[model samples]
Target chain A: MAHLTPTPVIEPLQDRTMILNMGPQHPSTHGVLRVILEIDGENVVRIMPDIGYLHTGIEKTCEAKFYQQVVPLTDRIDYLCPLTNNLCYALAVEKLLGMEIPPKAQWLRVLLNELTRINSHLVWLGTHALDIGAMTVFLYCFREREDILRIFEMVSGQRMMTSYFRIGGIALEPPLGFFEKVRDFADRFPSRVDEYENLLTGNPIWLMRTKGIARITAEDAIALGATGPTLRGSGVDLDLRRDMPYSGYENFKFKVPLGKEGDVFDRYMCRVAELRESLAIVKQALEGMPEGPIKANMPKVVLPDREKMKTEMEALIYHFKIITEGFSVPAGEVYQAVESPRGEMGYYVVSDGTAKPYRVHMRAACLANLQTLPLMCEGRLIADVVAAIGSIDIVLGEIDR
Target chain B: MALAPPITDLEKLKTHPALASLLDWNPGAIEGVKFDRDEMSIVIDRAHIRDACTLLRDHREFAFEFLSDVTCVDWYPSEPRFEVIYHLLSISKKERVRLKVRLDGSSPVVESITAVWPAANYFEREVFDLFGIRFSGHPYLRRIMMPEDWNGNPLRKDYPVEGYR
Candidate 1:
């Protein structure tokens, strides 16, 4: 019986590096990302990233759709921060249309975008902690994320793909109790953040795994085009919200958090600090809720009021016409950049005097940030590869779009 | 939380000293400059893209250190079939400028600015992937968002949105 039983055999490589494939299906690769790592024993010699498994060709699809019709497509790009994509595309098209959005709409956009930031960060923290072997923190983060998702569903009728931002303004004025619900959530969120800190901040294992690992310099971050927390974690004090304000972000008071060590732990601290700043902005927006129309006054580009469409013949006709034959934009191009959770999400839109765009290109932050992976992981232990990937906080949908 | 001043003003950016210095650097390189809806766009000859980008990045007064985006536009039946666009940012100034280079349909080739700003690496690869446009000296220019063995550049005007077998 012992002779009949087969034993598993192991082979060893001497004086040679072994090739290992990390993903396309692995759990910790985040989202369909594949990395080919060359390793010498436990140390990574080199790494090459292979993307595009999730490419939807959304950029090509934009050419066939109307300007207003493209908003829904942007929602699919970065699922975590759908409204930021919605806002960036809307702002670029709005620049071409030359329309003035109402102040109320602008302030609401500011408030919602901040909420989107918190939503995205929560997901990052949960999955990141889970990857690093902290199970309790993952569950706690999702509990709060559910509250935020509920708020999104209450306003936009969708949980994750809430394309709440329209060209001229937000999709709909939020329901009556929306602000109150948001206020309650905002009030309770800080203590929850404190709870997250209590779980991970003092844990020696968390510190040992994250601190001083996957380090990047400020200059390296800037040159590699890392943005959002990844860039800020490297001591670069550049936030589009503060530096290049759009959608009334300038009206809100908040701080841009910075990290000096440029390590995984520093990135974690920056994001935690950002959660506090975002909450402050949300509270300010709620307190100074403006009173005015939520949509722009441009009848040509904007859809007729739902109330007006019922009775007035003119409103009904305009609504029918705009929905069927989308408004035409002047022949030109515009670039709009917004501070999404991951980093700078930009849209370069070109119009050719037609309803359909001549070209629509997305400057996704995750793609550029992912390029720095090889630089950080090479010459380090293979265990740190997961930490490096998690620290980048990449969403493959955005990278491959 | 309280209100602070707005961070972006297109009008103030229009009169920036950096824009003035860029025009002064190589008068022959620029074709035209236009300001619309507070965004400034400068059309430059395709031949001088690398030099112009180098000037924009290295020159102290016009320190456009960030190459935010690189994309292309196709205008079928129009004289210049492709328009390669570059969006540059001056972080210290909080200002943005758009640079355009028109490429004839025949070749659609231009110099790579990756040397000036390493951030242009992935962006240029993306442009190559979607537009079939080539960068002159790109270290590794290949399909980024598409499979290595893909057919045509899907973003071109003639390529059907449904795609080809």
Candidate 2:
């Protein structure tokens, strides 16, 4: 009887937590990120992030290469906005050498960067929506993204890994009919954005999954080193291009979208708004497009024109020296940044008057922004994980790289 | 204000005599100002990093509130074996400064900045994972990029360039 009966007096038992490793290989992580979470009955108590699983030693590899050769590595960094990475690096190196880029090149850079921004957002929106079980949005996004990729192929001759932007300017002069194709895409893109908005903007499912989820205060976001859409979602007015203008962004007239509540929904809306802003910038670039040289006049640094090498002996010798011996940067270091689709993409380059860089480092925004994941996931349910990850809009190439 | 200068604290920093040492050297040797115009920074020795950083934080004029990035570089059996860089931010002044330290060969140990900026926890771990720099005060020093039982830091100078597990 005593064994079967419940004690009248109170007895206490210890509560234990369970630790689970999400991935160095799990597909949803978007990369090799392993998030160690402590759970109590499907509720997360603590989260620890494990990174560097895909560390390709890209930074160290940069040391063995000349400035121009490193553009290929930037393509692999985010894998989404390859042109943006190219531009950021080129700007930093150009600044180091105190070289001036022509207006046409600067404007063209803006145009391409904006297009690259659109491409990146579409991917993020599609993947984020799919992760939350909205299959149609993913399909629709991919349909339009394919067109963008085709255009990229037309201009750069490479689809995803286009190291199209060279140190001084573009690699190829935006191939024949490229401008018209971009214009056509820009013309139709606004309606397409609305279509995406129509499907998910007011949908109860999307709202439930996103709104009031993964909320971060402005102070907390900044304290965590957050930038781009994530920080904008928290209503921060800081924009690198606007506040610290680079690549002739001060000339463009586009609004920077902000969110009232730093939630998954807010971030989604901010990115959608950014899509429109990019289209506007692209249109402006084409309408005011200047007819001039794309690459700078630096024969030693910039690659020589294919025809010029045949006609000019000096051009031939310069080309040979650049590819064979490589150029040496002055002894110093510089950290340059630009607004990539994700956030602030910065490249820190150090030179000791050598063909190869003394040091090359990247401040990957995806990795930095993803650091706030645990803070966003702590109180939410397990199912909300998809929405939270979507909100951050991370590309593993950048995170793991 | 000349458009308020991109960074808020340019003139104030120029007035400080402590940073005057930079003016004596060629601008190229100091590298160039990065991110913004007002932001003042330069590289330093790896061994005296702790002392130098301590002074940077303690000094009245410089209040680097954040450590934005801590990354390493390997020159491949070259002059500068390892370059560990630290990016600092002064929120009050709205400026950023980068400090670099060089380690020529083995024993790539640099003082930890975890105390100065708590955000350094993740960054320092990445440096250790890639370049094998040992941060003395890191609470739970472990390889972030590799497995728990992994062998060598892949970002080192002598580390094989091509390998996969």
Q: What is the C-alpha lDDT of each candidate?
A: 0.87, 0.77
How high is the TM-score of chain A in model 1? Answer: 0.96
Listed in order, the DockQ scores are 0.34, 0.21
lDDT tens digits by residue: candidate 2, A190-285: 899999999999999999999899888877776667778998999987667776678889898889999989999999999999999989999999
Instruction: Write down the worst ten-residue block by lDDT for model 2 chain B.
Output: B1-10
Which candidate number maximizes TM-score? 1
Residue A341, candidate 1: Cα error in Å is: 0.5
Error of 2 at B90 (Å): 5.2
Give lDDT: candidate 1, residue A377.
86
Clashing pairs in model 1, backbone N/Cα/C closer than 3 A: none
Q: How does residue B161 of candidate 2 score in lDDT?
A: 57
TM-score list, all predictions: 0.93, 0.86
lDDT of 1 by residue, A238-261 (tens): 999988888988898999999998
Worst 10 residues of 2 chain A by lDDT: A3-12
